[model samples]
Target: MPDAIDLYDPDGYVDGPPHETFERLRNEQPVYWQPMPDGTGYWAVLRHADLVAVAREPKTYSAARGGVVLEDLAPETLAMMQDMLLAMDPPRHVGYRRNVAPQFVPRVINQLEPRVRTICREIMRDAAERGDVDFVHDVCAKLPSQVVGELVGIPEADWPQIHAWSERNSGGQDPDFSSGYSEDASNATIEMAMYAIGLAEQRRAEPRGDLTTLMLSMELDGEPMTDIQFGSFFVQLVTAGNDTTRTMLSSGLLALLDHPEQLAELRADPALIPGAVEEILRWANPLHYFRRTATRDARLGGVQIAEGQKVGMIYTSANRDAAVFRDPHRFDIHRDPNPHLSFGTGEHFCLGVHLARLEGRVFFEELFETFPTIEQTGPARRQRSNLNNALKSLPVRLCAV
Candidate 1:
């Protein structure tokens, strides 16, 4: 009905998200059937309400049954993904999340504000020194890498490697970021997991007051988390934390720069930075969608979905759903009751929501304070990936205050 929309093609997302296509799909076919190259296809849950319904009913729409990606992953990779919280179904998901959730609660995350601010200050100082910089990599990527490394007690020297592996893992569709080989992506995950396993072993022998040690000490399903489990959990935490936070910061800056008046408002009253962060998330959600498989024959958005069919909770469309946000296209920092599904919903909601928000707020605060003038030096480049709604490069000039 919508002129053969191809939501599965990574090429379609090279410039940016197919928001126009998404808008049309939401209007005509909220539960659109999108065919993938592999003959199998998923029901793209475009509307906000429908996506929520799918997410709420984990038993009906299972993450583990097919893993989270639209394409079928290799058996080993799928096994690793199943180990991560994102791809697990309850009550296993519940047990594992319960063990580590305490480390990420707002009260605990708030305690890291001072350190996050320090890191942001350092990043801003470096960006100010390099007046012209690729904001995506030089400015935005540094904070998450450092923050996650510190959080997980990763060796300072290994941070860059972890970041590189993360990029490869998430950037498989982007040739610039990835080698364009599926094996490379899988290898990156395995390599990271191996590294994480070693870290767990080291931390086990010499416990430290860090997340790594805490996680290793925690019990899942009435037993201590094994090294393999820690490896999967570590991979998820580092990769998710790094890529999503980088996207948020880079995209958030571009959004503010595009709307100078809103940017000015943020600079005038830094208190509004948090609200602006939410709007940024709503506007440019880092990940486009997360895949789930129908565990049984089910009906969603008036369409019948058979068992084993993939279902994608398309956050890009849902965030801009007219039914949810009034004037959803407008980038308003003060959008109260902003219920964007960027961090997802239900049992698999993001574990690092507080940390992500804190990083966003502090990074913006320090950025505006450090650089009074931020100008776009060149056109921004979006990542070529259906899953990752992130920028590949954002060239900008920053003038220090």
Candidate 2:
């Protein structure tokens, strides 16, 4: 008889936390088998240690083979996605990661805290004056687009277009969330790539002292990145920054709302916001999981995973793994020695981790400081996607201090 594997239904994970089912899987079948809607099933690595092992052994488990999603991307789409840093396999992945590492290093991101604060203050001000606003659009969405626009040489005026495109690129997975349009994600990806190509062409003539300049001048394997290459890089940075950071802000607020005492603690001691940010990341990660494919047949956590099969390193599950965190359900902002996989693990860890954290810390600090009496005036709504676990609407009212 086949092993009695704890099977989790993906539909349960779409709206929000799949705590009960995930808890059962974690305790009973740490390496669970989950069925896909399209008649396929995959082994879910539910334990934190197993996830680390899967990430570390990239030679056996690849990001390139079947692409990251449960269903394989079309050949053409797969080729385009392979150009992304997240999807590329080693030697190339290593080289590209190294090339961009200097730009996003901790010290560099740390310097942007003041600028981040300014952006957050402006965002808070715009929302505060309204008294009531859709927190997702008015508040959470601004910092990401602005930060990304500043990072690249994109003009501030063009931010809305970029934001729209970024939303579309990440949105095709959710028909309801993405303007109720059934636009193909591949088309959006191509459009974004083309937009970046134009920007690269413009920057090539007169290099500004910004990230666009860096991309234009910087060499990849002794060759300066082509316009096509810059397109891939631009899409990756823009879309990743757009979706994930927005999730952080929106979800972080939800966490605070759920934990009143912790929220009060943060208000009393603003210094605790730093640790609170870490806890937020741990408690409610922006992404559900990042999928990786196996290059060769491998055994992970004693389960025999077939070659070329897609495997997801579920940060959502790993962050709450009983072995890794104590009182895992509790949101303790003051929790120390917290090591969460919100940014991922291993060499392929998120390059924008520091910047994301800096933005989160500054945004929350400014939020509490400016609006002392912040509360959810209406019901919160969630996005409809297994991939993007975020709020669609948080009806909030903030009283100006």
Candidate 3:
């Protein structure tokens, strides 16, 4: 088994993403078959071009067919997931996304910058008061929770509960974040969905000027969004908004610290923060991969993928593809034309892309400005999950300016 590499094992990711193995696979077999513990396996698409090809042709590689994870979810769970934009295919996905796209466009997202910056300032001030913190939970997690909560018009008091549910949903593979039972993860989804359903009911009666009200008023397939559909969509938005942004901020800090020269450069020139965030995302993408099932037999990277087989567009590998990225392994804030697939591509590109970039840019700018000296106090711990490439804990000391 010396030559064997298990991409399916969550434990393999606890230390870090298996980049060395990924490089080897990318070189030898860009489209490799990986076996899961459940006696099933997937074709891991390691090359950037191949992954993009799979994403572009959604008709051939359906997100709705089997849902977007390697493990087949429970029948009910898969049904609920199918309602989300991430799991929907082109024609239907297009309509659902179009209904809400107005809310997340650059103009709409830019309007929230001042609020986002204010949230960052408050969070940084709180972190400064603490002096030392588990940066992941205490610092990085707050901005997204508040931003998303306010945008959705969820009561500020419920933000923590929403954050908790989001963590459990994505951190099911990590014991630090979830109970060993899969039921707990499912329950988190159900609980969040129920909360959303109640909120939708309230908004329908007394409409407000928030995304929730906008979504509730909008129609999909020429019919108003049903309560259950709203519930599913809410779960997707909250979970994606909370988890991925938190990961980006925490992981971005760690990446900056790892390269102090780059960190200093950013501090010297704050204008570089936006590019730095992009590089950080490319280096440490929040999601490792999203799954899609082949609708019919097709050839990918010269390999035959049979119908109904799971295919993983391995972003972690594709981000560092030597063919696309010059000096791929080296972290550079000024990596121009860095076409990383971190936010994905094609029809299923991230809905909150603008908001995420805004949060990232503002959070780092505020963090550096508020605390002149920020240093890691201890070892960073990573989440044990193949799907979520995230840090579980990052201990740091923030010295106030």
Which candidate tops lDDT?
Answer: 3
Q: Which is the better candidate, 1 or 3, if ranked by lDDT?
A: 3
Clashing residue pairs in candidate 1 (N, C-alpha, C atoms within 3 angstroms): none
Candidate 3, residues 63-149: lDDT per residue as tens digits? 999999889989999999999999998799998888888888999899999999999999988899999999999999999999999
Deviation (Å) of 236 in candidate 1: 0.5
Off by over 4 Å in 1: none
Q: Is candidate 2 or candidate 3 better by lDDT?
A: 3
Query: lDDT (CA) for every model shown?
Result: 0.93, 0.82, 0.94
Candidate 3, run of 10 with poorest lDDT: 1-10
How does candidate 3 score on lDDT? 0.94
Give one digit per residue, the lDDT tens place, for model 1 in 151-198: 999999999999999999999888887775566788899999999999
User: What residue pairs are clashing in model 2?
Assistant: none
Residue 339 lDDT in candidate 1: 96
Candidate 3 Cα outliers beyond 4 Å, as residue runs = 1-3
Q: How accurate is candidate 1 locally (lDDT)?
A: 0.93
